[model samples]
Target: MFELTRYDGRRRIRGSIYLSIGLSLLAAMVIWVYPSFEAEVDLDQLLAAYPEPILQVMGVRTMASLGGFLSFELYTFGWIILLGLYLAYATAGTIADDVDRGRMDVVLAMPISRSRVVGERFAAMAVPIVGANLLPPIVVYVGARLIGHPIGAADVLAVHLLSIPYLFACAGIGLFASVIFDRAAIAQRVALGVTFALFLSESLLTGTDAEAIGAIAPMRYYDPNAVLIDGSYDLVGAGILLAMTVSFLVAAQLWFQRIDIS
Candidate 1:
């Protein structure tokens, strides 16, 4: 059995702090500024400006108001950076770095299985990840409450909930790459490349020609704005993401079992 997080005595405390600060800044941007109170922008015009087909690709839908501020708006940025790319770099590097730094042999000889080792690494990285993902909505909630424009509790929760599956998918994929590749950089690029491609495929699925096929991508688990602003959760979409996350996690465990420590 394995948990992806544990406290090593020489923990990277600074690394975690940096992640928190970055997430805080992102929350400030999404909840406090731009569409919240600063810009007072129109939703319809923004939607109309972007082509209908293009809208589907970005995981955005017509919210008609600040409702657009919910799921999709946060996702528009979070998915690309937080979900799609960041964890890939973070997770893929952990084990591979151990191997490169001549620490893999030492760690593997401990009273632990390979699966547990990889899982612990993932959990450690996930500390900041969950923190980063959870911050935006928290910021939105606080700012909205303070500014007298409170977003619903459900709506705020939906954003964080919706993000988990998306982020976990990338996490699993990164674990796969980390086990397969020897170099962190290579694992990261491959992980990012594949995940982004899947995201785009999910995006491009908006068209009739590709719609039939693009649904295969895990990105379909979200309709960002709908869940973010309307408090609507796509049950089927969440189920699909959960399945993918589990599948990826299982795969990572099985795959890492065969990894050679020598």
Candidate 2:
């Protein structure tokens, strides 16, 4: 049923593996340095010296413990910010690049409809999203054990699982951009900018009068600190993210169906 999805997904697997390995190495490094950093530095004084707004924006609830440190260092910065932006950037090229290269015309000439093409192309983004999420948790978990601050497996699992919907929503934004722009470069830049702006909106608007506006941002729902540090899983937030993902995909499909690709 998803022939194009399979085709594109297979093409992405190697790149995804490389991304996973790189992230795993990063997770290892973060874990490796935590003990030395904690022993050498005064975490409480350091956190106290930081301004309130900066801590709020960084989502640094606590840094005295391993879970808290990883939540702030690895999950929040790496998973939420970096991975979200990467997915949006990668998926931004899906359709627009095809159109720019004259490949969309050939693909459209096949039996598939425009909606299916958009849907399948966006679906293929799971390759990198899933790959990046899957291996890093294992690395983080084992690394934490090696460092003697073993984190909970359930909490680690929850953090990665909850991130999936958030990452997919980011990809959906890229898919929407991919359908709107005919040029791959323009689409990719737009997607990256928009995704980052939404992240900023969510991070900067917290507890402010304009916090309501940040609700639309995917980052508002994905709280790695809640899961990893507090052991609290926000299933409702994940559901909302999944709904947003579907909405973006549907929006892209509808838009792609109306556009004149010729």
Candidate 3:
């Protein structure tokens, strides 16, 4: 299991490091520009001008502070969409690529059980996701302090910490897609499509009577703007996100175990 996990981890480490650096730099840039926005316009008014759906989708409530700005500019789109999409794409190839290349047959011929194989590969998928989540908060926090708009350390930590479960859930979705499809390209496309669709569903359904439907989407439980800006921590929401992650992973494991890899 450790060897399998390490194999997957090694495959992803270089790309994960590059992605982490890029995202951290973006977070820093967003934080560094907060003072310019504060000096130039009424952030509350600017953000309020957008429609509720747009605001909800963008995760922009109030840009009146550093936390809010970072939440809107960095965390919402950058973390949720860009990073989430990357993780999903990467995970979608975890099993499908090996299977498609005939590498899975060699592995299955060994002593490893199908469940352990799937679980270890899933663990490999998680290495990059967790690394991607870690560096941004430090960058955001240090940048905020450097610019004289010090966001609370706890708030920054909470935002990044809570994001782990959300990203994990997204990866789980991709993992399911990976096992369901034999081709990596098809699995990637399916994972990306489903992940983005869920995000849109959660965003667009915010105020409707059908909002209950959005509960199925993972983003419904993740509110970086509320957590980072308003210091609101939703333990129930975090729990739900974690539950979804486990459910998706378990489903993927069972499917992989039962399906014909040929």
Candidate 4:
């Protein structure tokens, strides 16, 4: 099981490293610009020009300081949309690519049970997600300190720590799609589309008559802005996200175990 996890994790390390570096740089850039915004713009007034719904969607409840700015501009969209899409894209190929290329047959013929294969592969998918989530907070923290903004350690920690379950849930959805589709590209597209659609639905449906519909989305529970800016960490929401992650992975495992890999 460890070997299987290692093998799959090694395959994804290069891409994961690149993604982490890119996100770190982006965080630094966002942090670097905070002083300029403070010097030039009245953030409250600037944010007030936008509609309330637009502000909510953008995760901009407050922009008075660096934590608020980083939460609004960097973590909310970058972590949610870009990181979510990347994880889905990466996990979508975990099984589908192997099956599509006839590699799954080789893997299955190794005396391993189908359950172990699926479970270990999904475990491997977590490497990149965890790696991608870690580096950005360090960059954001360092950058904030350098600029003298010095965001609260707890707030910075909360934003990245809570993100783990959110990304896992997104990847679990991709894993499910990967098992359903034989073609890697098709699986990836479906995963990406569904991930984005969930986010869109959450953004559009929240605070409406059908807000419960949006509650089905993982994004509905994740609010980096709330964690970082308002200092509000939703432990229950994190638990729900984690529960959804497990549910999706269990569904993928069960389905993959019963399916004919050949």
Choose the strongest candidate by lDDT: 2
Residue 59 CA displacement from its true place in model 3, Å: 2.4
Q: Estimate each model's TM-score.
A: 0.83, 0.98, 0.96, 0.95
Q: Against the correct fold, how does model 2 do in TM-score?
A: 0.98
Q: How much is the lDDT of residue 236 in candidate 2?
A: 95
Q: After superposition, how far is residue 128 of candidate 1 from its true place, in Å?
A: 1.8
User: Candidate 1 lDDT, tens digit per residue, 1-262?
Assistant: 4423556312645665676667667766665564444356576676788877777666666545445654455557665545567766667777767776678888777889887887777666656556666556667778767756677878777767777777776777777888787777788778888777877776776666767676666667666666655567887887887788677767877877886665
Off by over 4 Å in 2: none
Worst 10 residues of 1 by lDDT: 1-10
Tens-digit per-residue lDDT, 44-154, candidate 2: 689999999889888898889988898888888898889989999899899999998988999999998999999888889999988998789999989999989999999
How many residue pairs clash (N, CA or C atoms closer than 3 angstroms) in each of the candidate models, in the order given?
Answer: 10, 0, 0, 0
Per-residue lDDT for 120-207 in model 4, tens only?
A: 8889977888888778888887788899988888888888889988999999889899999989999999999999999888988878
Task: Give per-model CA RMSD.
Answer: 3.1, 0.9, 1.2, 1.4
Q: What is the alpha-carbon lDDT of model 3 when measured against the actual structure? A: 0.86
Cα lDDT listed for each candidate: 0.68, 0.91, 0.86, 0.87
Q: Which candidate do you rate higher for TM-score, 2 or 4?
A: 2
Task: Provide the global lDDT of candidate 4 against the true structure.
Answer: 0.87
Sort order, lDDT high to low: 2, 4, 3, 1
How many clashes (backbone atoms < 3 Å, residues ≥3 apart in a chain or on different chains) does model 2 have? 0
Q: List the residue pairs that clash in candidate 1.
A: 4-119, 4-123, 5-123, 57-203, 70-228, 70-229, 71-224, 71-228, 72-224, 72-225
